[model samples]
Target: MTPAIITKDLTKKFGDFTAVNGINFEAARGEIFGFLGPNGSGKTTTIRMMLGLLPPTAGEIQALGISVKGNQAELQQRVGYMSQRFSLYNDLTVQQNLQFYGAAYGLNKVDLKNRIQDALAMAGLEGRENAKTKDLSGGWRQRLALSTAILHRPELIFLDEPTAGVDPISRRAFWDLLYQLVADGVTVFVTTHYMDEAEHCHDLAFIQRGNIIARGSPARIKETMMDGQVLEISTSDAIKTVKVLRAAQKAGKIPLKEVELYGSLVHVVAPNIEKKINDIQAILKKAEIRTEQMAVIEASLEDVFIASMK
Candidate 1:
């Protein structure tokens, strides 16, 4: 199958600064492709160019087998989009908002009514059809936003941090909707700050400083970072122990990728970690420290992201 989205030498600039440097990639149909990166990494810029919302300084964009160069009008109808910020009309009733958008899409009165009801049902806002948009809570607002985006069941969806700042419960519910979409063959391209969210995608695009550093299954990303194991050392002196681990890792005494401090605990990222645990304990002992506990564990995607960003 042809990729759902494609780009080549995709680049964008803002006067003196290059927001998105030469980048290229493809997202297969029905795949939940994640765009991951730190702030100012140009993920948003690239997405805008793909959607034909922002013209790229230079490059080619293909969406659903159609060139986006000047056919954006034909392409927009088949793609759903939700931005990082809420885009619904706060003053309108839920039903009214849905109706307005439905009409804009050229749905007839009967079809529009049915589509509104379907959207409300899918978003779990069935009983709030007459409620004003502003009266709903944050989670409800999110549901409405999602409901509106998929109101037309666009073939492809672009969600930019759709769950950011949402509580874990709401985030999970939002992800569940995405799962249903993919099941129905609707491709989703999403960007998010939450690693747990990214882990749900079929594949991830990890970018930094305008570069696509990694792209693969979440499991692959985590495994690629697992050149070694990670161990946590809990002690009363977090500062001292963390300092020692950092210096050790830097000086080659510890063959670890990173050392991070969390309160009274120091996490060491290393390979052949079993052999170094006792050695680390010895070093801690020299500092007149008492260890509370030490254990080995798998590294988190967050850890890999930090290491990658470094």
Candidate 2:
């Protein structure tokens, strides 16, 4: 089957800086493709290039099996985009906003009416059609924005940090909506900073400093990119434990690849961490830090991503 989106050596530059270096990836139809990256890592730039809103300095992008270059108008009609910021009119009523977007996408009056009703139902705003968009909560606004973006039912949708500021429950709910879209054969390309959200994607690409440092399914990335096993240490002072462990690694006292603090726990990654587990506990104990519990645990997407960033 043809891929929903494809890019080869896709690149973008701004005079002295390259926002996106040569990066290659593909998104299959009816799948959630997560583009993960930190701020200024070219995720947004790449999305803009794919949407044909910004021209790439070099390379090619094929979205929906059509070349994005010189075919933006054609592509625009077939794809929907929800930008990082809210794109709907805050002053408009919920139904009005949906109507405007439906019309903007050239939906006929009859189709618009049906789509408006669907959008209202999808957003759980059936009786709140007359409510001002500005008065809705962040979660409601996010759902409304999504409903509006899909008002025309495009084949593919690009969502840039769609759940950024929403609460965890809302984020989960938004992802539920995405799964529903995929079940209905809509392809989703989303860029996000949430590691949990990344885990939900069918496939993922981690970009940093304009380069794709890692790419694969969540399981594959954890298996391939993690060079060492993770040792989860429940400690009294995670921050200070990390500092001590980092210093030990740097000073050649401990052979650890990464040391990070996860809440009250300290995670240390190293090859054969079990062999050095005793040494780790001894080192922390000598520093007067109590090691409550220690165990080898599975590598998480966050662990792999931080390692990749380094």
Candidate 3:
């Protein structure tokens, strides 16, 4: 089957500045594809071009087996979009918002009614239909917005940082809904900056400064992009541990790839670091920083992401 989305050498520019520069990739049918990047990394610009909202300066795009340029009217009916900003009216009730979007999608009265119920149940907003959209919690409002976007049963959906400000529990709940959609044969193209969320995607493209630095599944990226082994250290003070390790690396006391603080722990990356464990211990011991624990551990996606950026 043809991929759900295809872009070849896609490029977008605003005057002399290039927002998305010659990026290329494909999102497969019925799979979640994550576009991972930091802020100002051209993720939104690329999505707009794929949706035909912004014309690309170069290259071609095909969505759902159809060209996006001249067939926008037909494509709009087959795809859904939930933007970074809220798209629903604050003053409208939950049911009212769904009704409005359904009508905009040209759903007939009979089909609209059934689809509305399905949407309400899917969003867990059946009894809250009469509540004002502004009165809902951030999580509830996000779910409602997602429900509205999918009311017309589009085959493909584009979500732009859908879980940005929501709490962790709510973000997990929202991802559950996305999993359900994929199981029902919907293609999800989501962009997010969260590394943990990127792990949930079937495949991913890591973008930085309008360039794709790496592309693969979480496991593949970690295996291929990570430059060396990771040494996890638990010390009395994480900040002090990082400072000492970095100083040691700069002074030629030990060879290390990267030293960063991870929560309360310190992670040091280097090649064949196991052979230098004693040297690391001796340095920390001299610094009077107690080494509670230290071991070589597997590299995480966040580790690979940070290394790739450097």
Candidate 4:
């Protein structure tokens, strides 16, 4: 079967600066494909080109088996987009917002009514229809946005950082809705910086300054991209631990691939890290940074992502 979205050397530029440079990837039908990167990493640029909102400087974009540049009007009818920011009207009531967008998608009265009911139920906003959109919490608003985007039953959806400001519970709930969409045979092409959320995707492409450095499943990327094991160190001070380890690495005291802070803990990445545990402990001990615990742990997607960027 043809992929849901396919790009070959897809390039976009603004003046002389290339925002998305010769990037290629494919999102299979009925799957969640994640585009992972930090801010200003060409994620939004690529999405815009795919949606035909921005024309590419070069190369091709075939979404749902049609050329995005040539057949935008038809593609718009077959695809949905939930932008990075909330695009709904704040003063409008939930019912009013849905009704407006549904009509804008060209739904007639009867189908619009039925689809509005489905969207409200999907968003869990049944009783809140009369409530103003601005009155809803961040999570509620995000769900409503997703509901509005899909009111047309598009074959593919583009979500640009859909869960940015929401809480963890809400993020998880929103992902549940995405899972339902996939189960129902809708292709989801989502862009996110959250590694935990990236883990949930079936496939991913890691972008940096417009280039795709890594592309694969979460497990495959971790398995192939990381050249060493990650030694997790729980120290008295995360900042100090990273500083000391980084100094030691720079001064040739330890053969470290990367020293990074993960919340309150420090992770040291290197080949055969188990053999250098004593050296690591000794350096921290000399620096008066107490090592509460040290263990060689599995590398996470974030670890692989950081490694790839370096």
Please give the CA lDDT of all the candidate structures. 0.86, 0.92, 0.94, 0.94
TM-score of each: 0.93, 0.98, 0.98, 0.98
**Runs in model 3 lying further than 4 Å from the true structure:** none
Residue-level lDDT tens digits of model 2 in 166-208: 9999888889899999999999999999999999999999999
Worst 10 residues of 1 by lDDT: 254-263
For residue 285, model 4's alpha carbon misses the true position, in angstroms, by: 1.1
Say which candidate scores most in TM-score: 4
Show where candidate 4 strays beyond 4 Å: none
Runs in model 2 with CA error above 4 Å? none
Choose the strongest candidate by lDDT. 4
Name the better of 1 and 3 by lDDT: 3
- Name every residue pair that clashes in candidate 3: none
Ranking by lDDT: 4, 3, 2, 1
Write down the TM-score for model 1: 0.93
lDDT tens readout by residue for model 1, 222-241: 88856677788899688888
Error of 3 at 170 (Å): 0.9
- Winner on lDDT between 2 and 4 is 4
- Compose the digit string of candidate 3's lDDT tens values, residues 215-255: 98989999899878999999998899899989999999899
Q: Return whichever of 1 and 2 wins on TM-score.
A: 2
